[model samples]
Target: MNRARALWERVPAPVVDIVLVTVAAMDLWPMLWDDTRLGVALAALGCAALAFRRRFPLGVFLLTLPVALTQPFAIAPLVALFTLAARSRNRPLLAVCVALAAVTSSVPWPLASFSEVGRAMTLIDFVYSLATAVAPVLCGQLLQAHRDLARRLAEVEEAREHERMLHAQAVLARERAQLAREMHDVVSHQVSLIAVQAGAMQVATKDPNAKEAARTIRSLSVTTLDELRTMVTLLRASGGHATELTPQPTLADLHKLVESSGTQAQLSGELPPTVGTPAQRALYRTVQEALTNVRKHAPGATGCVELWQDGDHVGVTVTNSPPTRPSLALPGSQHGLVGLRERADILHGTLEAGPTTEGGYQVRLRIPLSTD
Candidate 1:
């Protein structure tokens, strides 16, 4: 069946119409003996009009009116009525055309009924003829209705799919903006500290050459800070609400963070006085992010925050034991560790944050330092 349809599709439409016309003409051939010239003329004209029925359904329907008079219950008239009913959207006009086609057929051509059945047609014959006339038009309307419904469904589905795609794109754009803000936070904090440290160094240096170099360093650091600030502003401005210009968390907040942790969180070891503000803030964030993760991923877990300094680096670690009970699943964007990693990179430091063999999560941050 599919192969036949495919072949029909491959055939030219005009060729298909010509074939239908020939078949219809053949069906009306038996009646051609009586009307002779009239019968043959009507048959040829009505059958040929079927060729353009799809393009001009109403016109072809009107053209086949004479064929209905000659052979009322014929193939040619029925095909024309079907074409009009299927193609025309004007319902009243279609109904009028179909009514005319059926009514004209009730009267025989050359003023006589079919003698083979009876001299005068019976009521049953007339009813059957009317039924046959109506059936094809009804079938055509039903098929056309199905086609229209399918087309409407397809359009609705395409619209829904387009909206879904746009929503997905918006989500991706928002996530990109958020990631940029996280990176900006880390860079700004580190750059701000650099500017401050450079200004202090310029003041402390006594030697002329050292002081000149320190001044240059201070100027460059200030410029870097300005650029970072601009970038951070742009990234955060993507959202509808304005970004809050909050102060970064530092060593001063370390005690508060530990106190706030519901777990048995303790801050141990002394922080070096020489540790820069950037390093302090980085350490504070490392501990803060780790503790937050613990609360989220391992509720009821105990944690310890350790801050210390070695000869060349300032170090901090936040460790949480496994949950006392079962872990509680929590909703998180999981951007904390990514931000911590960015901070460490900005300070030319290394951070280790992962699960321990003891069924705990550990975070370690180390920022490099040098003595002038």
Candidate 2:
């Protein structure tokens, strides 16, 4: 069936015109014995007009009008009428064309003689012409109506799909709100209590080592609580993108990020002077998550951070050597790497993370610079 439709579409317009002309010639051949050579001319002209029916529908219909008056057979003009109705439905124009067909095709018996029988025959001719013209016009109208209904149905389906997506987003927002509340109430409270206990320990301790350890614990606890608060606030934000008053970290802040991790890390290479915010954030998070993974899963490993611009893209790579000491910790949510992948997607960038040939874990990110 598909191949048949393909072949039909590939058939040339000139070939179609030639086929129509052949049919018209055959229709006119029977009438030649009546000495009306004009039948051949009218048939040829009518069929030839169909070649431009799609481009000039009304004009082609008008061109075929002569055939309706000169001959009893009018296959070409009927096809023209069908084409006009299928392409565009103008009630007044089609009505006029149908009326003209009925009137022009009516026999001229009244002109030949004023007998009652001749008038009756002319009426019969008019009725027959009207019936023939009406059939093709009705068929074309049916086709046009079917096309209109299909278009409307497709639009309604698209609207329904859009509504479904919006509802899903609303549900996601509500769930995120609930999660933010839980983190703020339970997790933040426990971390805050730890900070307070550490502070108390610093004040009560007498040994220098004990005092220093308590101070370090208090500082770490406070920092952790602050980070949790920031995360919860971001989660509570109402859109796909979280908007904060402060600017997000950039390439220049990479140094501070590595230093804060407390791992034996070194950064090498020059940074681009200007970078898109999305790319900068993606690379920063890529480096941040890579460092966190090393700390949690590959402890006491030396870390390397490299940032550079190559052609129209900026790239960052982070690598960590194998852990010197093994631990019994198992993987949790793996959300850090998941979040990094999402960030790279948002920037239309690429990220790769896995163990390297040298028995070390590595993460690499490459982001194209936006022309805009």
Candidate 3:
């Protein structure tokens, strides 16, 4: 049934109109052979007029009425009436047209013969013609109702899909909120103790090497606490409100970050103040990750962080010299560079990290200055 309907819709409008005109002409052909020139002309006009019934349904129905008057049970007028009924919403107007068609079909042509016909016989014919006229109007109204129902069903389905998406988002938000609470309450408290203990150890130590180790542990723990706080804020913000998040790091905080990194590092060069917030964050994260790596894997090494702008792009490059002393083994997930590369990709940028020719490591990130 669906395939049939699809095929029917694929047929051109003009082709359907032509088919209707042919069927109407066939219906009136026999009556035209026995009629006067005026009757023949009226029949031909009514048949041809069906081709335009879809556009001018009322006018076409009026034209087909003459053909119906010349003969009983005409097809042209019924098709015209159906077209008008489907397109028009005026019920009184449709009822009047139906009545006019029934009367025209029942009345004997050439009005002089009406007196010869019996009243009872005329009434029977009129009743039968009225019943015939009603069929097409009912069919047209049913089609109109079907179209309206289909449109309403489509709208309901669309609304259901939207509701499903909103429900999924709400579930995800709840999960994120719970995770944020865990990080703040449990993880943050533990990291605070590690930083406090390291600070106490640094103060109590006598050997220079032990003192340096304690200071480095304290610095790393403090940095981790700050990052944990930031993460908690981010998770809570994701759960409901953007206003929950603390102010993120930008170029303004670069000096403080380097000063507290527990490494020998130099900050140089300058980007335009017009650089966007996201690019600034990416740049800062790149330098932070680089200095942390130097402190862990390149003990006693010094690093340089340079910021520059080239044409439409702004970038930061961090380079560190080879270790002056043998490095200690450190636990790491090794996802820092991967995360940085992902962040660069989100901003339509790139990150490159590799060893320089001078037995040192270089990490560079370039992103659009207008990145949001």
lDDT by residue for model 2 (249-319), tens = 78788898787774679999976667877787788888888887887788679999998888988889999
Estimated TM-score for each candidate: 0.53, 0.69, 0.72
Weakest ten-residue segment in model 2 by summed lDDT:
108-117
> lDDT (0-100) at residue 357 of candidate 2?
88
Question: What local lDDT score does residue 155 receive in model 3, on the 0 to 100 scale?
Answer: 94
lDDT of 1 by residue, 9-54 (tens): 7998888898889988888887777667867887789889999999
Task: List the candidate numbers ranked by TM-score, top first.
Answer: 3, 2, 1
What TM-score does candidate 1 get on C-alpha atoms? 0.53
Candidate 2 Cα misplacement greater than 4 A, ranges: 1-63, 87-96, 109-117, 194-234, 240-246, 271-282, 293-372
Predicted structure with the largest lDDT when compared to the true one: 3
- Cα lDDT computed for each candidate against the true fold: 0.77, 0.80, 0.90
Q: RMSD in Å for candidate 2, one decimal? A: 5.3
Per-residue lDDT of 44 in model 1: 84
Off by over 4 Å in 1: 1-12, 30-34, 112-122, 199-372
* Per-model RMSD to reference: 15.8, 5.3, 5.1
Model 2, residue 96: what's the lDDT?
A: 90
> Which pairs clash in the backbone of model 1?
none
Query: Where does the lowest 10-residue lDDT sum fall in candidate 3?
Result: 237-246
User: How should the candidates be ordered by lDDT, best one leading?
Assistant: 3, 2, 1
RMSD of 1: 15.8
